[model samples]
Target: MKFSPHAWAKLIYLRDRGTTEVGGFGITDPGQPRFVKDIVLVSQSCTEITVAFDDTAVADFFDDQIDAGRHPEQFARIWIHTHPGRSAEPSGVDHETFARVFGNCDWAVMFILARNGATYAELKRTGNPHSEPLSVGIDFRDEFAGSNQAVWEGEYLRCVQAAPMPPIWDLDLLPGDEPYLSEQWPWLPI
Candidate 1:
């Protein structure tokens, strides 16, 4: 999805916080780990979401953003966070929090930072305890990584299986369109 400038700013803001680990809790999935990148509220309605840092300061920041009354919705909340050394999977704590807070709204967004590398975002559909993964596509390219840069850019959907460990993919490869690595993050850059 194309993000607004506000969303981009939020992502940069989170990165600037420079935390090794970050998370959030709200009406929904409080404990679930979210690697926030950016967020957007149009006229008080929660329609757009970006990324941001995981810090205690976020609650106040959100409140202030909403209080400014710049959007279409009367009230809005956006949550973001970081994952320094661990994978983006929701921990046990996250599961409990999600179960508790999710009742507050019709929808919520969750973002997960992958160590120092990439970020993952999920648009959660409230109501059903179990739901399908919403796919989000991002474009990211670093000249230092060689041709693999474009390969790493594409669509990512929520994984239904158990969360995997870090270094989510093996970097080793042979010359081919398909990744030589046996397992890979569906959302990771090709």
Candidate 2:
């Protein structure tokens, strides 16, 4: 697995879940090399022992991404979470979750990041239900990381000039709507 230096940085340095595990989407190439482009962090409500994703929200996000023309290979193909200790091995729950959630992918990957930045990774291709998860290599090139820094800084600058989105949920309301409920709002509610 290859990753933009920024993604690696986020995985290694940001453990927002305190002493527990934290996870996020690993957006990568849908083909060979599978270089990760970004890390979209998922919010967690856990402490120093366990963790889980908001599966519905995560799945919905993937659905939206797919609808938006991003290919399935980029659909959070890798499941990444940090371990509080030095061992990056997957626990029982990790193995179970990987099978349940990522089993349908053409190929699935897992990255278990240790607290001290050590890493362990594995990959399982679909249709090999009984096969052992195979080990994969992680490459964090310094040049790529440097490019990531530049891209991130550029994005931050762009956001400065962009308009912030309005806040509203569970309603047919949209950003430009003035007469909020005129004509029944058109779209079905989630």
Candidate 3:
């Protein structure tokens, strides 16, 4: 769950402005120092305790990467969201959502960001569905220069102002219309 300085900076900016955003990106490799790149940010509402992403956001992220010549399946996925005014620790719902949606990946990471910059991150391997989440530390390096700082700040503000969108999946989908557990997320086999 280690984040690049640029990613951390952008996340910190969002936290300071009281924005709740859902973020995810593809990882470059399978092990160590797990550098996440090309993070795509999704806007959220002020009242949200758990930020969620729409299918369009997920599709667009992969679409852009594919257009740039990268295969969507080539990257491991990590999903993140802000938990404002709460402990950065993952909630029960967080654990369930992470396990259910990302269960098919070889491994996946769920990160929670809080207002004070306190964070709780967990890395899970799908093999042990009920295993306790391994808490991980974030490596937020100080790499923001003046220009990039300003840009990150502006994006944060824009995030706060962005129109709120509803969650992509309806909690009460009609029985047969409901996606199977494996189908809840796109990158997995049913």
Best by lDDT: 2
**What lDDT is obtained when candidate 2 is compared to the true structure?**
0.59
Per-residue CA lDDT of candidate 3, range 1-190, in tens?
4566656666666555554444445344334435653345544334344455556656766676678776444343577666554356665566777778888877777776767566766777756755445444545464543326666656454444433533545323211111322233333232
Clashing pairs in 3: none
Q: Please give each candidate's TM-score.
A: 0.43, 0.65, 0.64
RMSD score of candidate 1 (Å): 14.5
lDDT of candidate 2 at residue 188, scale 0 to 100 = 28
Model 2 lDDT per residue over 41-121, tens place = 554443332455656656777777888788777866777777665556665556777878888877878877777666767
Q: What stretches of model 3 exceed 4 Å from their correct place? A: 19-22, 26-33, 43-46, 71-76, 130-190
Q: In candidate 2, which residue ranges exceed 4 Å CA deviation?
A: 30-33, 130-190
lDDT tens per residue, model 1, 1-190: 2233333444334333433233333221223222222342111111001122223344554577557653312123333444443355543333444445544656665555445445555555666666445444432431222222121111011101112233423322211123312132344455
Estimate the TM-score for candidate 3.
0.64
Residue 118, candidate 1: Cα error in Å is 4.0
Cα-based lDDT at residue 19, candidate 2? 54
